[model samples]
Target chain A: MTDTRMATDAAATWHARLDSPDMDWEDFGRWLDADPSHRAAYDAIAVLDAEIGERAAAIAALLPANDDEVAVPASDAGVPDAGSASRGTRWRWAAIGTSGALAAGLALLLVAPSNDGAAQVYATGRSETRSVTLDDGSRMQIDRGSRVSVTGGGTPVIEIAQGAASFAVRHDPSRVLMVRAGGYEVRDVGTRFDVVSARGRVAITVAQGMVSVVPSGGAIGDATMLNAGQSLTITPDKQIAIRGRIDPARVADWTDGRLDYDGAPLTLVAADISRYADSPLVVDPSAADLRFSGVLTIGDGSRLVDQLRAVLPIRARRVAGVVHLDAAGPR
Target chain B: MLAANRHQLVRFFTGRTGSVAEAEDVVQEIWLHVGQPPKADGVTGEPGAGPIANPLAYLHRVGMNIVLDRVRANGRRQRRDAGYVDATTSTVGAEAIDDAPSAFDAVADKERMARLTTALTGPPEGAMRVFRRHRIDGASHAEIAAEFGISRSAVEKHIAVALRHLRKALDD
Candidate 1:
């Protein structure tokens, strides 16, 4: 095969493999880095897959109709969040245990986690919010567009694969509740802490008691102690920044529809807004660094944009699907 | 003019809001607003009260303004259901809601949907079944292969063929 043909075929195979839970990321990374063409081909395939997934229902409707409702496989081992998988598909998975290998793969992919013990996955959809009490007596408030897998039989562990979650743990020294996000892990030494993993940044805020932030991959030395009224933000590039003396009560104020930004970058604010609303809010590179301080009540997503326009010397316009914020022209 | 281009307007709103339901609501609100008198206490049936020199442009401008107002006025306050709580238990969930794509994204998505519909017809029936079961039905490859009485590798190959064909069609 020609090099281009080979790359395309390899990309297709990679796409199929990655969709399975058994994919070895280390091997995939090596293959991705091996050739530049591979990366391009992979990107193309990924985009296509995402597009197809988004419109799967609509396209499927147009195809030759098959009324056979796939039955859900008998076991609940692979069920992540029942709400996440449409009821029809869940039943199909539950009923389709004809092949043990496929049933195992379905469980792994749907409940995608690396837990030593049995894990239960919790997920919130675009605008959905769910609060669940763990078997260990800990309460977790899940953020929108977020998923966290909880493994509780021995030591309680939370693996936040995406979005943010606020944890209010009942102080138990005998069984530590651990939160793993990105490359860092927050071990609760009996405390209430908010762990936000969004936009390539993980910020851990200690509302009460104390917690230790340790690098999961050992990229850094020692567990950093974060006490009450303190916050630690780790950027994707592994740069650690610490903030002291933040109001402990204000930690997770978003639960009350209030976003308190004390001199926060506009880009960060935009990222937060993008989480709640669909419109892509773009701050011009020139205005991206502008800092804002105050309380913005997020009602409808657009009002926040209006509030920003009122407070700062910026022009906000909704063009097509994008909300563009630019430095206002000199009067 | 707005009535003439109702479908187009709905598409425009859908692109703006990233939701067909919201788009329909916006269009309905716009229709109501257009029928209402511009000023309260004015005659609802008065001649030329609702007429515009450039009806198309006027319809679009009014439609967009209403959407903006609706967005500004809308506030989503999530009531806390009795599930879990601590000292800091609040009524609202600390999360973003209804993350919609911008107009550009909606347009692109529409284009992709059209392309996907066309490309989906290219693969053979067995390959299409594999792709559909895995993608739409959310079945595992092993399950799909078993259902079709095919080997695991063959199932993967069928899916790869379907994906490659679709990806190629998209690139072109």
Candidate 2:
């Protein structure tokens, strides 16, 4: 076979294998890194596969169906009749249109912020993350279990009631957007920043522009100007610390359903996950201080414990509706 | 053991099938095959039978077989559907047309469906069968190989050919 043909076939095989229940991810990673063409080919097939699957029913209906074929039970075949099929087609197209509108809304949220008193309150459930368009046209992606109320008139103000929220604030010299996250306030001159308030701690990370972090009732002298790629952590004990050179890419990783950490305390990991899970995840005193580094992909939340167990000398179990993580004993 | 791997298997198949909902059905089918002993007397004498040395590998093998079988079934369906279309179009003047797709259907949906139909119709019969069994009916490659009296590698080649054809047709 020609090299290209070989690569394509290999990519297809790998794609199927990766989906296999017993796939070894490490092996797959090795194969992916072996050849650049392999990754490209695999990506091509994956994208096409998704597109076709998304329209699988419509495509199946478009095929000429025999009287006998109709009896063949493909329950997912949504196009059983002309009338209902038309409805399905309309719904699909409507969804496509909504996504287009979302794109436009996203553009406006980034480029424009109008100061008008359009009060909007956005909140997310334990398992929900919501993106809101403020009256000023700025956008905020509220994390799971987070609540934020926005007032868009003259110097728009956002009150982060609880949990984490990321802002893509539009630059306006005439007005400054102020975010009241717990006792700390983040005043955006024209910037993108994330405020995470959890576990008696508040963290502010900037992705772009500059923001000043000030105490709720303190003088401007105490205010600290944080530029792009900076992070500030405030504890309940009133200790404020700043960490520079924050990887901007990691600022809002949670929005993508991933928790990216590098040498972070397992206690904090458990705390972050507790926001989404039904039961609180408790780290035993010994395991609490142990640090872990990895990307935990959020699914059903059980994977977090599984991954933690895999790399650490730890054990996780559900006891009385609470998840507990403790140091493991050797067999 | 199967229950523990259920989510992982679903995630795996989701990548291939592109829909988690569809992938759930595929994973469930794998579980059924695993739970069945493949014997009336419950004897464990068959080759590689009894205790399933590695459940993950077993699940993987069975899942692949299911995909291959699905490919074969889809190929048969395509041929049958094609014949039905041909007969109807040929008898247009002689026979009263029935169940003809309405022209009022959404044009974009129709166009996409047309591309898929065209893609499914053109591959070689054997390759198409293998492809359909796996891709459409969720048959595993192993089962397809066994049913067709061919090596597993041959089945893979057939599927690869079908995939290439579908990819090319859809890309166009």
Candidate 3:
């Protein structure tokens, strides 16, 4: 076989194992490294595979059903005429048992760490939520498009770098959990609260117990103590801090696919919607300060803007990939 | 885990892009996607969220997807540039000004779909059926093998044959 043909065959074999649990990525990496031609061949095959996947529904509509299967005789058994020529090479792509491979791979990665405490970063993709439990039995339900990192040693510190996260900390008198976001810090001891830090703003809503929110570089005495049903937001400019009341049950409602807001700024709502949006949802300056109060169900995250438009006098326009929301003209 | 395997991931990307700087950029992009937190916390309870079965494989898949998106974007840009030049050179002022990039993309997409349809018929006799079943219909190799009364390997071979044929046709 020619070198190109050989590489194509190898690429095909690799493509078949793309989703297999036992996929040996190390070997695949080596194959790509071995020859530049191999990478080119594999790229062609991978891109073709993705294209086919994208147009699968359209292609399915174009093709006819495989009714010929019923016409073949039982005595001919499983041999296809087109496959007969390559019968000798059939063993090359034989199916292997896949059970337990996924479990084994997960096991290798989830090994419990030592008390030395190395930081681990956890993040969620668009419209994807993740729940992580800390060593001290604290649970965190991370919202989509959010990033949180935790370091467990003597004192546990949780940082919400972007997006929103809800924390339910287990009571530990010896350890005070420190949660930080947008240059502000929250100290918690056996409490549940939600923190949203995005677009240069940090908002924390207390659902249960009490937590102290401290400004960046502020002493503990300067911390604002928030009780249950209380919410505080530090604006993007850090010039104004807003404290409001919220129903404790409404905290982190996105976990149930519903965003419950009680008079939230349009800018803050836009920032929350941007997590599920394929593109950034920017509010026009005219609509930025509008207060919105409603429950928006985030089903697949497609109709969020439409839902917002129905409730408020806002018009959303797509220019390129960004969604710009402006106040609608009088209708 | 991403931090621990950074070097290997960079090497893997470098092999594909054939440039260390490009590979480093890709790895950095991945890091930004994954989000890096400054501090750490202790963890001990069961994973309350859906667990990714294999994160390394997941990361590799994500890397390949990023590469594919970049390649597709480059292709679209090149096509759009060529189309823009054609419109400006062949048409008068008003007509040329009316031809937007979005319209050009629509026309290019239609042409590409036509080419794909033409290439669909280039595969071997039985290969098309297997490919359609596995790729379009979302059937597993084992399921296709059972339906055809053939071994799973036969199903894979048929798919490979179809892909090879389609690649050749489309490349031309």
Clashes of each: 19, 30, 10
| DockQ for all models | 0.08, 0.05, 0.15
Encode model 2's per-residue lDDT on A12-78: one tens digit a residue. 5555433222335434444545656655666666445534533444555554564122111222121
Question: DockQ: which candidate is best?
Answer: 3
Q: Is the docking of candidate 2 incorrect, acceptable, medium or high quality?
A: incorrect
Q: What Cα-based lDDT does every candidate model obtain?
A: 0.60, 0.58, 0.66
lDDT for B141 in candidate 3 is 67
Give per-residue lDDT, candidate 2, residue A15: 51
Score residue A4 of candidate 3 by CA lDDT.
Answer: 92
Total clashes for model 1: 19
Tell me each candidate's TM-score.
Answer: 0.40, 0.41, 0.49
Kindly report which residue stretches of model 2 are placed more than 4 angstroms away from their true locations once superposed.
A1-118, A237-245, A300-303, A317-323, B1-172
lDDT string, candidate 3, A205-229, tens digits: 9898767677767754355667678
Best prediction by lDDT: 3
Per-residue alpha-carbon lDDT of candidate 1 for residues A1-331, written as tens digits (9 for 90 to 100) = 5777667767777566543333333344456556667656765665466446545567788766753454322221121221111112211122223324333422222111111234567888765667878655578888877888776432467888877788887643333468988778887744788888766678888888767677875522255666678888787576765555568888876667678888878887776766566677788877876998888876544477877788988998789988888889863
| Cα deviation of A239, candidate 1, in Å | 3.7
